[model samples]
Target: MRPPIDSGTVLITGACSRIGRELARQLARRARTLVLVAHQKEPLEELRDELLASNPTLGVAVEKCDLSHPDEVDALLDSLHRHLIQVDVLVNNAEQGEFGLYEQQRWPHIHQMLRANVSAPMLLTHRLLRRMVERGRGGILNIGSGGGRLYIPGMAVYAGTRHFLEGFTESLRLELVGTGVVVTRVEPGPVAVDAHAPPSWMSISAVRCAREALEGFERASPLVYPGLAYRWMMRLVSLMPRPLMRATGMMAAKKLRQGTALLEERGQRVLLAGGPEALSR
Candidate 1:
């Protein structure tokens, strides 16, 4: 069984993209109100319309702002505050990943990735944690990647940021132990959202992933892995020696790169539903 969110407002970052979009859609029907955050203006608006079209009674507000820019996030939050918005659930779902050696990765891109994946969520939590603490009830789900626990060669920075969240969420959960405020870290495997280049792994649909994630959210678990396959894979990987895990990551990355090259040569970019840049970048 899970707790109901009849009167709580939910805020979802990157709400126009694959997983985020699906999460917003799933929660809109049950959640009292929703604040959707995304970087692009037009797409965010489009998502807002789509949601409203389906659920006219749903209270949905779209904020077009780049989470990579702390200033913009602050502005958006400030606007929400001025309007007396009360958030009861937060989904830190915005993140960008770059695959390559740390030395070869561009610095600017790394900084943006860090800001989006780590700093932005941390900042948002810092600002909103007080409210949830004061109200003595709410939930915060930090969406992370399996790379947080499993080492992958081409994703050092990505892995580090996700691992940091693993530690951060655990510590926060302890602090909010008796406060009725729950914190959970949701680690989903290679979602079909951005699994264009792959070794033919079965990627779970974004809607399915969101559904499973929210099921865990309602349970208020401290940590959740969405799919059974991901759970089994993690268990098996955890049993493997560290050296073996590293070798497997290298092999996987190599295979992905080979596929990417093949697709690029054909002048056809494999991407998520919305657009190519949305997935490839």
Candidate 2:
């Protein structure tokens, strides 16, 4: 079933980030009310103001909540209930990824990734899906990564979390078959996040990614692989045998280790020390 985007009150988590912000911008012209949820209060407020500036008739509510914490998730839900705001659409886009060798990665970063990438989305879906089922109309969009299906070297934990997301979304879509709720998981390849770095031939702009995501959601596609070249590449990757993939991953891991050693020799931080942009690809 098509989601009621034309007039629905959409709740978008991680609304201040790239894909989330783009989704909000496109939905602003259609969705009745946008509840922007994110960790930073200033960014969410800024996004709300900018969205309203472009869409004067639109209603926007900025909520500050860190999805890495379960108690904060409950607080967010309570705030929604207290305000009597019924979320007709839920977009689970909040994510945290740390790129490093599995043994060298910090426990805190891994825990945060587990909570934000897996636990938070599951909690939000569980809380809001019941009302959607009862109302007989709603949509759930999960923004995941191609790494979920592919073997990535430095992002072991991040990739594992994404794999769980893909599995959970697929299973949930099956269960919601007759419930009149739409579920879509968008698996995007390398997305252009930094302007200073030269664009990769395989990477797509964030705008294109968001546009393709919505197209897939509206079509009720169970899974969406955005970007033409990337889509074809994933298709080819899917055809690869597990042993070959493992061998390929081994090569990549060796390169990553070499890069880390070379950079450390020059007294420089690791490649992904910058942030998720490295592993986000």
Candidate 3:
């Protein structure tokens, strides 16, 4: 059974951009109170204002903390608890990805990505899961990627982190079988959030993906594909042999390199900097 929609507050991490921002807006329509969390203050403030503009009486709060830092993540949660705030919906939307080979990636960036993508979520969920279990009514939505299910070269660490989340979510669902708390893992393929793919791919818009995620949450679905393409892709990938999948990934990588080289030759800035695209390889 699904939980009541308008009964409580929701806390969304990485609530400042793209899918996270849209999810916040949609949830705000049903949730009585919202806590928007992000690493940057400016975007969070902007989102808070935007929400307030839409719902004048909406109780929107902004929290700024670097989740990559364990201390900061804990401190942020502590501050919320101090204010007597209870998170009925915990959207672990924050993620950091890599764009290069594992060995080529700097130690600091890899460490930070691991911390934010894996450690922070694990720690935060550990703290909140117990409470949600006790309450017997809560929603946990984790934003994952298709990289986890496929063998992508440049994203070794990134895919590893997402795969861990996927495994964790499944194990957690089993553990909470009889509990009312719902756990959802959203694996979106080529979201239009500055992905590193060539310009030909039609990636799902972030808003569309966010809407699907919220809809899935309402239905208490354990896993959701943000778009039809991704759903079909998952099935296809699952049917492919392991070695075949690796070979396909290699072919895709070679094509991407070819395109990148062509663009660079034409004096086009081959790198798409900033936003989620920077995370893409």
Candidate 4:
């Protein structure tokens, strides 16, 4: 049987962003309370209002927290404690990624990403997983990336962090086998977030990604690849040799080093353009 998600108090980080926002919307009808956490308060307030309008009985708590900072994370936890809310499900959905050569990337950006992507989730899990184990029924859903499985010259630190999540989640699932606490990690490839940009056949909408993630979480899947095509692609990538993947990465790196690859910042996403037509656009 799948682990129960209904009537639970769920805490979701990156609550205002694409996947996190979709997760909140989908779970609002089933979850008793949704504790929304993000760096900004305004967006969370707006989303909170929208959710309540849809599900009047649903409880919503908006927390403004910069996950990169340790003190703010502590404050978030303290606030939840003061409110007497025991989280039954924890969704570590917040993330940071950079598309550039590792050495060329800003140290501050790298540091912040490490804290947000690695330390925050680890601390949150450590702080909350004990209670879940005690209760013997709970969930932890980690929103990671496909970068974890491949050799990417750029986004090295981000990929490393995701690899950590992949290992941590798999090992935690093993330890929690008989404890009844469901642990799952969703590695989404390309989730469609923009309406104006040209759509890719490989990209799935945020809603579909969230829906698939929840389905996998309920089934207690150790790892989940969101889109159908992306899922099959990841499976194939796993079957291939590491040297072959490295060779592909080297070819991309060659383009980047030779100035043929252009990294364009589109809204929240970083787009990598390879050819003349791509660069022209």
Each prediction's TM-score against the native? Answer: 0.85, 0.93, 0.88, 0.90
User: What is the C-alpha lDDT profile of model 4 across 1-281, one tens digit per residue?
Assistant: 45557999999999998889999999998999999999999999999999999999999999999999989999999999999989999999998776666766678988998999999999999898899889888899999888778777666787799899999988888998998799999998877665224436777888888999999999888899987889999999999998898899899778775552343332232333221112223
Give the TM-score comparing model 2 with the true structure, all chains together: 0.93
Candidate 3 local lDDT, 28-117, one digit each (tens): 888888999999999899888889888887788789989999999999889989988888878898987756545546788889988999
Sort by lDDT, top down from the best: 2, 4, 3, 1
Model 2, range 20-72, lDDT digits (tens) per residue? 88889999999999999999999999999999999999999899999999999
Arrange candidates by TM-score, highest first: which order?
2, 4, 3, 1
Task: Note the clash tally of each candidate.
Answer: 0, 0, 1, 0
Please report how far candidate 2 places residue 24 from its true position, in Å.
0.4
Weakest 10 consecutive residues of candidate 2 by summed lDDT: 271-280
Single out the weakest 10-residue window by summed lDDT for candidate 4. 272-281
lDDT of 1 by residue, 75-185 (tens): 989988998988888899988876655665678888988898889999999998898888888888899877788876557778888888999998998998888887888
Clashing pairs in 3: 194-277
RMSD of each: 4.7, 2.3, 4.0, 4.6
**lDDT for each of the candidates?**
0.79, 0.88, 0.80, 0.85
Q: Which regions in candidate 1 have their CA more than 4 angstroms from the true location?
A: 1-4, 194-201, 247-281
The whole-model C-alpha lDDT of candidate 1 against the native structure comes to: 0.79
Error of 4 at 131 (Å): 0.8
